[model samples]
Target: MAWYMNSVEDLAELYNRVKEKNIPIERVSDHGHAIGIYIHDPDGNGIELSYEMPASEWGHDPSGYMIGGTAKGRLSGPWDEALARQAQVTA
Candidate 1:
């Protein structure tokens, strides 16, 4: 399952809080149009916590389905709280 968050900062905060609880998180990864953290429920059901990238950065297939590439080398840490705050002010 997948859950969407508003921004990278929001996702980062959630990740930090979840981590402090000692819940096993699988990994953090980028999916082109989003960043995600993979985890499993107590029963082992897969879950993804994700933050969608801006629509301007999203790509689509010929059939109009969103097609995202892997972001294996992208950084996922040290979210710029300032940037998020700026965005909120401008938005």
Candidate 2:
């Protein structure tokens, strides 16, 4: 449900094209260097299109990784133990 447009003008043009086809667009907004649009697909699921931040803002930085048991506050219950023991599987 996401897309990237290099510039605002391209985003606007695409919006107009869809409008010509009588589609329903809920809203559009600018998020700093990126822009996002919200709409409903024909089946009514929400959809989002976005232009991502410049590549400089993204890279391999392990500092952002969250320790499994530390998420959602201190792990104090059975669910926490299950999460901690989950196999190291990646999708």
Candidate 3:
């Protein structure tokens, strides 16, 4: 189960809200141009919330299929939250 978000900032906001509500997030990761949040539903079904970077930032193979790389540096937590807030303000 998964849902795609529009931007990293959107994902950040969702993450903050979910945390505020005491929802347990299993994990968070960055997959190149995208970020993913893994969580479980009340029924214990796995769910993933994803946010992809803009098309301009995406990498493509020769055949034009999108390619993703492993995350570099931190993907979530206070630093990301601060960045997300700044992005929101700028946007």
TM of each candidate vs. truth = 0.61, 0.51, 0.65
Please rank every candidate by TM-score, starting with the best: 3, 1, 2
Work out how many backbone clashes candidate 1 has.
0
Worst 10 residues of 1 by lDDT: 71-80
- The lDDT leader among the candidates is 3
Full-model lDDT, candidate 2: 0.53
RMSD of each: 10.1, 14.4, 8.3
Q: Is candidate 1 or candidate 3 better by lDDT?
A: 3
Please write out the lDDT profile of model 3 over residues 12-44, one tens digit for every residue: 788877788888877666566677778899999
Q: Specify the highest-TM-score model's number.
A: 3
C-alpha positional error of residue 25 in candidate 3 after TM-score superposition, expressed in Å: 0.9
Q: Which ten residues in a row have the lowest lDDT in candidate 2?
A: 69-78
Clashing pairs in 3: none
Worst 10-residue lDDT window, candidate 3 = 70-79
Per candidate, the number of residue pairs that clash is 0, 0, 0
Quote the positional error of residue 31 for candidate 1 in Å: 2.7
